[model samples]
Target: MTIFACMPVFCAIPTTYLSGSAAAGGTAVINSLALPGGFVSPAIMGWAKTTTGSFTSGLYMMAALLVAGGLAVLLGMPARTLQETR
Candidate 1:
């Protein structure tokens, strides 16, 4: 729920610098790439639960991945103004 709530803000991060066909193509590519993870992660979480016989580990793993993603955004993603990208 929180993830979906925050998606618009995150989505805006990329869209702000793109326009016209570039923006459309970039959005298409981003959705295409992101789709697989949406499918794969639940299966991975289910596997983790099955092997461990508890959902705790799976939840922890999800939390860890969330932290890693946050860190990636903070450390790896470069801050660029709209003018910079263009």
Candidate 2:
């Protein structure tokens, strides 16, 4: 679980930085500047109102979820292993 949780933290490093940059650049740059409704759409929707802060907050939540999901998977592995052992 610990290792799994850490994986998100590791993955988050780049995302965090990117999110910050996107936020600093504003929603126009984050959304319109990038691919047409490819990835920026979600970022814009998540950010809402095209604000850097909102985008950062949204990305933070996403990163946290990534960590949580990783942890869940990691934790589940042990349980599954134990079950098979039994």
Candidate 3:
């Protein structure tokens, strides 16, 4: 769960930094090619200027939360059934 929760923060740090660097130089990195031109181009430029970072980071964070929550639910299931039996 801890790892799951931290995955977003981990991915975000590098993604934000690299995007900012690319935008500042007005050059695209190979990874940036995967990003949508209309949406991500403007977003990366905005993030570079504002230092606010990527929406993808937020997505990663949400995914981490979901993974952590799912793990928690799975871990609790056995206890839940035990209580029901009692």
Candidate 4:
């Protein structure tokens, strides 16, 4: 519920800032990558639950991945250089 609600808002952030081809390409790439995760994540969660006999470990792992993804976006995504801004 929360994830579904937040995803559109989060996706909107990039689209609001980017323009033209960059905006189109960026959203396209984001959607393309995210589409597969929908399938893959459930498989992972199911496997984790089967192996551990509970969802706790899988939830924790998902939380850890979320943290890692946030860190990657914060630290790894390059800021626009002055040359590009002009």
Per-model lDDT: 0.77, 0.54, 0.53, 0.78
lDDT of 3 at 71: 77
Clashes per candidate, residues 3 or more apart or on different chains: 0, 1, 0, 0
For candidate 4, write residues 1-86 as lDDT tens digits: 76677678668756766998898888998899889988988988999999999999988888787777767665754566324656
**Model 1 C-alpha lDDT per residue in residues 52-73, reported as the tens digit of each score:** 9998898888888878876876
Model 2 residue 67 distance off true place after TM-score fit, in angstroms: 0.4
Every model's Cα RMSD, please? 3.8, 14.0, 15.8, 4.3
Can you give the TM-score per candidate against the true fold? Answer: 0.76, 0.34, 0.32, 0.75
Candidate 2: count the clashes. Answer: 1
Candidate 4 achieves a global lDDT of 0.78
Off by over 4 Å in 4: 1-6, 78-86
Residues 1-86 of candidate 3: C-alpha lDDT, one tens digit per residue: 86457545534534543566654443334236435545855655566555645566545655665577557644755665547658
| Cα distance off (Å), candidate 4, residue 9 | 4.7
Off by over 4 Å in 3: 1-51, 79-86
State in Å the error of residue 31, model 1.
0.7
